[model samples]
Target: MNILFYNDSQDQLFHISPRQRRVALAVALIMAFLTLAALFFAGTKLPVMSAFFPVLGAWGVMGDVLTSFILFNQFRSSRIFPLLLLACTFLLTGILSLFYLLSLTGMLPLSGLFASGSQTAVWLWCFWHSCFPLGILLFMGSLHFNKKIIDRRLLPRYLFSGTTAVLLIGVLLLALATAGQDKLPVLIEDGNYRRLIETAVGPAIWALCALASVCSVFPYKKRGVLRVWLSVAVFAFLLGVTLSLAAGERYTLGWYGARIDSLIASTVVLLSIISEVNKLFVRLRRQHEELEESQQALESANEQLKELSGIDSLTRIANRRKFDEVLKQELNAPQRAKEHLSLLMIDIDFFKAYNDHYGHLGGDMVLRSVAPRLEAEALAHFGFTARYGGEEFAIILPGHSELEAEQIAELMLESVRSLAIPHQYSDVSDQITISIGGCTLRPGEKSNAHDFIGRADEALYRAKHEGRARFVFANSARDSCLHPFETTSH
Candidate 1:
């Protein structure tokens, strides 16, 4: 039923849920038992059961019409050729069934329309059964045609106009051909005549049925629920035809069995459609959850990338860019205007000589060893440390005066000396040491990151000039530079 709505081009059978699979198995087993029982007792007929034939026929008509509506709606949404054909087939079958049912009940306005129990009704009956199979054959044959031939924008118009024309033509021909011909020779009177008619019409219906079965197989070659059920539908159709032939008389037990077979065959596709719909909803929900999870994972990865961008790759600390950004933010921040902030400039003394003697690789190890100590001391003092450039690092301490900044710098100096990294090429003690320059100020509207950094750099130069292993303070007053006792240490 949903074969027309199928979007997958891979020629595989449609999937179904476990629950649907179980339902299909139950339906198949019941249908199989019904077919066997009907065949086993072909001659026996209960008048009560036979009386309900009309009711069952009415139900079959309604089912086909409803199924047609569903298929047509699907056709409108998907614009698939197979869906359109199936919808039309069901609709036409429903109409034909109505005509046949009206004749059986003697309610048709056209009394000449193959009047009940008449010879012409036999021919019409055979023709009615053949109509749906022919439509199925047409659908199967056209599957290989170019899809572009049916323009979607004009499809509804074509369908309406084309079906109208065909219906009108068929009605006109049926009326004209059968007019005044109700009294024709008996179609089933003589055994030879019956055999002749059967031989002539039987092959045509069987050939169409065979072709339809072939078509069903072509679409779903892969093993799956849809393929299994579709094959069952086609087999049921063939079995119904067989039962009709074996009945050998109208209104017999075999005839009722044939009708039951037709009903089951027609409904198999509809049952599959319902099952497939449930599975589709389940799959869509799973896919939606997966999509949401993937989006969240992507957001998390992007945040990690953003953080990495602001960090130095070698030392895994805040880089120069991060330091510059923070310095600008601190200088302009209104909340910190009256609050003391200090910048410390620390340089590894004789780093170039150290790199040359120990090689750049060993110098990189010494730099990595020294950075964590500096970062820990700055962080403990409620500050952030960054690698300002090669051989130099800067710490930004908010709410820290010059005296408090000096203490933080002392801790960092001690932390580096504690490492006691050997430096054979140093002019100072044969271990790594850093010169510290400390600058403290209360930021104002006029304060800039460049000037703040320049004062610290100048202090650092002063510290290096005096001796390479001591701390100096750059006074904010333009005329004054202070040395914190110049406690030089190695």
Candidate 2:
């Protein structure tokens, strides 16, 4: 779902479908034909053609600005060297285009902004076009010789310093050119010949762009779509340069043709970036949805795990750990002070002797059998049951008084006796039996939950001491009860 298309293992915009390639080629050919036709037809008429050149120049500037923004966004995310250079080049192209446009229309505040004198605009035009090729050459060099220069931490400083230096140098050169404009010959005048500076600089800039375009073709074993497109843009730019020289004067047919070619070059890069951004947005949305679903599934799993950790595996009841947690809550809970709460600690009488006679498996079976009976008595009276340990269980009655707890304990005793499980080695009786001890108190009476459990344990010990198959109630003198059972049916 990560739609960030790049050249390595990632999805790249360079891999175009056959239909898309065809469409692109058609558009390129159309633009080239239109440019050539316009240049040839407009050559004879200067006044009509001059008015449209400014508009085309402005369109070129806007396209360069947009392409620069797209590249900058890519650079911010990837911090790649080539993207940075391309972004900077596009930005410079935009600024230079604006100056060229303003100077051609006589709107520039300073005469030196875009020209030295008669050919000042032409010199600025050469510098503006040269920046792109220079940036591409640097990008190529970074790919091969300076691979480590793409450090994210240093990129901002490099961009700022480089941009500032470029601006400063441009300003200084324009000023110097303006001061020397008077001495420079008018190359476009009726009889004035072109000077060496004008003759040499323009062709040299065009040559650099051509050389860079050629260099771009062999960066890797196979050429990528991006490289091919870059070369195409450079070639188109070179064509525009040739058209400008052929026009030999401002506002001529060749001037309009050159501006149109520049506009087309900027548009090509802009269109590709737009397509890439659209794909990226779709991918980001899909990843976000997938992340939300995973979060919900993880939350459900955690809840199940929490429930399992508090349960007893063998008896299928709340375990000792759960019992301790509930007891602590009840003892400290403020609402418990308004009602009676009782703790019943029950133990299987002579369970050790029963295990010796019946084996560990039999002991486990007995524990399981007794657990449900305890739970039934506790639940029937609005209480909770838990297995405190082997052959022992605890019950919590939240709103029950001492008398009600005693009755429930007696019912539990009868429920277990009804099972009639055999125990020949038991000293008490031939049938299985249990001893119950209970304590009832308001939660505020005890300082801690463990103190309450300690008092209940004392009562259970007393029940065992007196005799098995009996119930002992311990809380206050008014609530104390020691109910013993007589010998029953064998």
Candidate 3:
């Protein structure tokens, strides 16, 4: 199963499950309740914690850096613009956090490299919080604006120019906040000062960020994996902002809770990316198994086809084509001269008359019956057999002399007659009979397959002319009665 699938061509869409959307919604609801409670306690001050800002600032820098790097890697796979924006958004937040920490610690502007004051850290915090939601708002809305996939050739240009633009914007904002902190209205409500968020600016910023988060998780719309998680992230950031500046007081319960909300914002998207990686591994493993099974099935089919191509369908013996191929291979083999090769040809007697009387079906039965006996006797002598043509068969006896070849041929003659199948049309006997002719010769460098087969075929013609059922060897003549085993069934 494809566990998660992003629309690589579309900037802000993917296929997602109901469970994922439900989980995002759950986080939004839980955070919303907590944020409301924190706002209720916003005006109430708590014990001042000096380490709170430093701890949160360090975490924000590290967390946003990790989150941005992951999204940047994801953007490479899809070439989507929203992914790039999300990456840059995280990067901006991370850099702003770093500067805020450095300025607050009095570690920045080392050796007068830059300038900062007591208000620099608070303004940096304002810019960081403000840009994060704005970036996310653009990311979700760009779903309609950027529909086509960016070409690979144009990716570098987009990356460089886009990154350059964000960097410049961040630099200008840093300069405004740091070198000119006195001119701008202070955001932090320290001592007798008032918070900017508590006045007319409060409702506008909250409404806009809340709208962006709420729209992303619209119940009727399809919220994909990335969008769902990002929706959760933005809502968490909304909660942080709500808790931090709505009361305009430091060391309040909401002030501490805002840092926790910021952490949730960075973690949610990282969780989504991790889920994607795990599913990809599972998909690759399944594909590997399928590929192995397909390979085995193909190999098995090839073996069956190879066997079928060489086998005779009717008689269950090797076909004439297979016989020709085997003979040529053995004759031309490098080790052929080390032993003798024997070719024996057999023919049924008066087979035309038998078929004319019994019809072709009966004739087929006789041929099938005769083929097995020939094969059995040939195999007993360590020989190979094939059906040469209609009413004819051949055998090859490797490492056999003319005496061994003749003995095997004679045994085949007796075996066929012993079947006791009635012929009724043969001149030789009341039962079917066959003529055998064989030749045994050591294979030489110049040996040809046709010459070896023809020598045996010549002997078979002589055997048929001499008698209907008899054995003949090409090299010499022998009287059948002279052998100890003689059959008179034919």
The predicted structure with the larger TM-score, 1 or 3, is 3
Most lDDT-accurate candidate: 3
Better of 2 and 3 by lDDT: 3
Question: What RMSD, rounded to one decimal, does every model reach?
Answer: 20.3, 19.7, 20.5
The TM-score obtained by model 1 is 0.51
Q: Note the residue pairs that clash in candidate 2.
A: 115-120, 116-120, 116-177
lDDT of each: 0.70, 0.71, 0.76
- Residue-wise C-alpha lDDT for candidate 3, range 357-406, written one tens digit per residue: 99999999999999989888888887778999999999988878777777
Model 1 residue 381 CA deviation in Å: 39
- Tens-digit lDDT string for candidate 1 (341-391): 899999999999998888999989987998988998887887888998998
Output the number of the TM-score-best candidate.
3
Candidate 2 vs candidate 3: which has greater TM-score? 3
How do the residues 1-490 of candidate 2 rate in per-residue lDDT, one tens digit apiece? 1112335522233565566556555765776686677656544435655568677888888988888777776766666666667777777788777766776677765543444355566556766888778877886675555434256788778678756865675566465445655555444454122342365766677688778767765643343345545556766776777677656655567766777778877767787667756766888899889888878886796577448658788888889988987788777777776888899999999999988889999999999899998998888897889999988899999888877788788788889988889988877778898988888886446656687777788888888887767778775454333332463321
What is the alpha-carbon lDDT of model 1 when measured against the actual structure?
0.70
